[model samples]
Target: MGIVTSLLPFSIRCEPDGDVLCAHLAKGNRQIDELREQPPTSVLFHGPQGYVSPSWYATKREHGRVVPTWNFVVVQVWGTPTIRDDVQWLREQIEELTNAAEKGFRMPWKVADAPEDFIQAQMKGIVGLEIPVSRIEGKRKLSQNQPDRNQAGVIAGLRETGQEALADAVAEGRRQPDDFSLAK
Candidate 1:
């Protein structure tokens, strides 16, 4: 499978259903057109990422040889797309997506927030997509190449810059060395 398109307009929301990964798109979305024409495709999700300065390395003062790099987490999913144009399916997909995205809110929004007729009219403009996932690849690049002391220094620098999330990610990576791997 090759890239159908990147940076598609809508934020792609996907969930696993049995062996398949389901995604939702609008009726006129370019991805929908591409998926219809070419079913084989990939969906990539980029998680937290940050720049790591050479100064953050504990070894920088020793040899002054360290170079800047980046740390990140990413996931790639490959599959063949199957379009779902059913009105009921689109409604259900919209409701589920809305619910999941709004879960953190004090009072989450629901599809029922709008009038039934209004929602029905809106649902007509969308479509559902089901991809039977063939493979999945994930990577977590969080200063794993550095020694323990250097990694700690990087984490400290990150926390100083109010990047606690990235710092925590690096710390977590250090803790679970065997869990996160680039290998399939």
Candidate 2:
């Protein structure tokens, strides 16, 4: 099978019922076709990621040996995707996804807010996906290999540049046990 990749918006929820990843794609999307043809697929979720300049490392000043690197957190999930065209299932998937995405807003929007016929028409133009995750891997590269002083410098630099999420990840990485590996 050929490799096919598509950037899709998705959500994951784990509950007693089941743990599944959900996403919707426009009707006739090639990625959906590929998934139907080749059941096995991998979904990559990207977390905070950014460039870390060598200047952010304290060792850069000590010996000019530091090189630029990227700091990021990402998760890869492998599974066979199941496509759903049932309107009810699609509606529930979209509503749940919308609710999660809008939770932080003071005035959240609901799928029900739209006209019933309009919502039905929209749903017809899309398909829902359910991926039962089989294997998962995560990686966090956050200056974990650097000295404590260098890590602190990286955090300060990231924060100074308004990369708060990445800065926070770097701080969290330092709190991990000494035996913690960058990838798991």
Candidate 3:
């Protein structure tokens, strides 16, 4: 079968064992159907990302050589999937997911807050997936190609626009050495 791309809003979690990733799919979704065939799969995860304007670069004012770009962090994982329909495993996965998502709430909701029968019934409509990671690649593009002043400008621009996460990433990127010849 050919590759079928899907942009699923999955509640993904990396297992403590560090070897696998877990998520779920609605039973009838095409992606779930394809995974049942035991084909190789790839999952992409996006971290902080944002648009960058040339106006934020010091070089743009000193010289007209800068162009708008995007700053982002991403990870891609490849593996063969194991489809699971076991109720117990599904329950555990969902509970962990729920706890993580609701951690910031003053009153966090839980799976047990709902009736057991209703939770069980809802589980029937979804299947769990475990992908034993075979390979992982990551990239962080946080204005590493620019000079120090320009990078500082980007950090300020991102923060002023309410992109604190991306701004932090840019600041962190400044500490990491890169191979870009233009970096200073």
Candidate 4:
């Protein structure tokens, strides 16, 4: 409950392979309905993102005017999530997550200083999640369907727009097959 709220932002990758999901409000005491929580084992997270122009889509070149499309990266982890009621563990997890998230921020939230009534009330809303992951699916749909030239162009555009990682991921995505084979 405490750690996650106090720690600065940290990337929580699903086990070994899934992509990093977006930041979650780690207040252990936050309500379930108020959270966008998923099954503990569900590996899902996304961070900063932006829209990708239809101009980047490989299918766009043929059409003079095409609908705009977005390019983004997603990580999915499929697994069962377990909730923990241990107060100490919940507080520790919260604290860890919080410290990891708030490194740069001047004003950080603390669990200790929070009103006991308010905090206690928040307890029911929060429960620790134990996600034992099973399968991982990572997708970075940048623009792999296009020719090398077009891909290069898209990558350049993403980099120019300060989306280098996405550009690289998308560029590489074009070459990768959906299913893995013994030989690369």
Candidate 5:
């Protein structure tokens, strides 16, 4: 939250009115689903996901059966986004973020350590967008509905497909046992 994106893989900022400034960095081919003319203030950042085995479906007729599925955890925040025009503020904010990200590291990089000219040039090419949260929500779709055995099956299947993240999330969600459960 401070300012470092390195610890966290990526982040994006857009405007309050959904007007401008949104960046997306995921898999090289991951799509950026936002219209340019309309910048959405609801910025969504995701971490990881893996496949959920269909065997996890509680409604399944039998175990070790047909197709599989996927599960994941995601976060979405909506707010008024502002574009920072003050260069000084942007620099300070970026520095703060960097320090926060590197707080636990033994040797953290410092903005001041870089040459002034190089820093200025780098700053010139980049812009900052402010996103103030007005609404925040978390969505974690997992296999809570499945029986313990099926949940294990899903985890196994996810591991097999190399989608361990998704499998792990579904497994965790199942441990909670709640409404909107994905058992079906």
Candidate 6:
């Protein structure tokens, strides 16, 4: 949740562990300084999304009355972020993070692939974050607000734009019950 912004393009990587979220950030990052003063943080995870033009709606052609919208899926995690500067913890965090990200690749890379001294030096530059989860909220704004035919039109438009993933998301949303009251 720590928003690391610097002159250089260094990004903080957040990892999830059970009920807590972790982030690997630079030692002297502005975000770290801000967190020291105020610990609360919120991390947002955004899934596939694309702009939906009125032209993508079947109703627009039938009645000439429709508006633009966007389709997206997002999750927000809220908690207090704690910074830990332990070398072992950072090493493990980096290892797990690397493994998870590389698992689907043809050739996965490991921290051990690099020299120990070099890796040790790299680890020293960052700190680990542990944010105990207080609340987690999620939302999916697909074409659920539209009629079935309009939803299909949106899916077709998304696919035409080479956004198969977004089209798939809309299709998935369409499969859900209209009333999500059962969801906790």
- Residue-level lDDT of model 2, residues 1-184, one tens digit each, is 3676778888886856556788999987878777666477888888899999999888898999889999888878877798888898899989998999899999999999999999999999999988877677788888989999999999999999999999999999777642322221
Predicted structure 5: clash tally: 11
Residues 50-157 of candidate 3 have per-residue lDDT tens digits of 999999888888988988999998878788899999999899889978888899999999999999999999999999998887777778899988899999999999
- Give the Cα error of residue 119 in candidate 2, in Å: 0.3
Model 4, 1-184: lDDT tens per residue? 2212222243454545543332223444453332335434344455334566657545466665555556666755555544557777666666667666667788877677777778667765655655455566666655555567667767777788998777777766787754331210
Question: Mind giving the per-residue lDDT tens digits that candidate 6 earns over 30-142?
Answer: 67767665466777777798899889888997999898987888766677777778888788778877887789989899889999999999888988877777777778889
Worst 10 residues of 2 by lDDT: 175-184
TM-scores of all predicted structures: 0.85, 0.90, 0.88, 0.57, 0.62, 0.84
Q: Where in model 4 is the C-alpha error above 4 Å?
A: 1-43, 47-50, 54-68, 104-125, 160-165, 171-184
Candidate 3, residue 176: Cα displacement in angstroms equals 2.8
Error of 6 at 147 (Å): 0.6
By summed lDDT, which 10 consecutive residues of candidate 4 come out lowest?
A: 1-10
Q: What are the candidates' C-alpha RMSDs?
A: 3.5, 2.8, 4.7, 8.1, 8.7, 4.5
lDDT score, candidate 6, position 91: 85
Error of 3 at 4 (Å): 2.5
Residues 100-184 of candidate 1: C-alpha lDDT, one tens digit per residue: 7899999998999899999988878877887666677788899999999899999999999888989999999876552332321
Clashes of each: 0, 0, 0, 30, 11, 0
Q: Model 6: C-alpha RMSD to truth? A: 4.5
Q: List the residue pairs that clash in candidate 2.
A: none
Candidate 5 residue spans exceeding 4 A from truth: 1-40, 55-66, 100-106, 159-167, 175-184
| Overall lDDT per candidate, in order of appearance | 0.77, 0.85, 0.84, 0.56, 0.57, 0.77
In candidate 4 the C-alpha lDDT for residue 90 amounts to 62
Backbone clashes in candidate 6 total 0
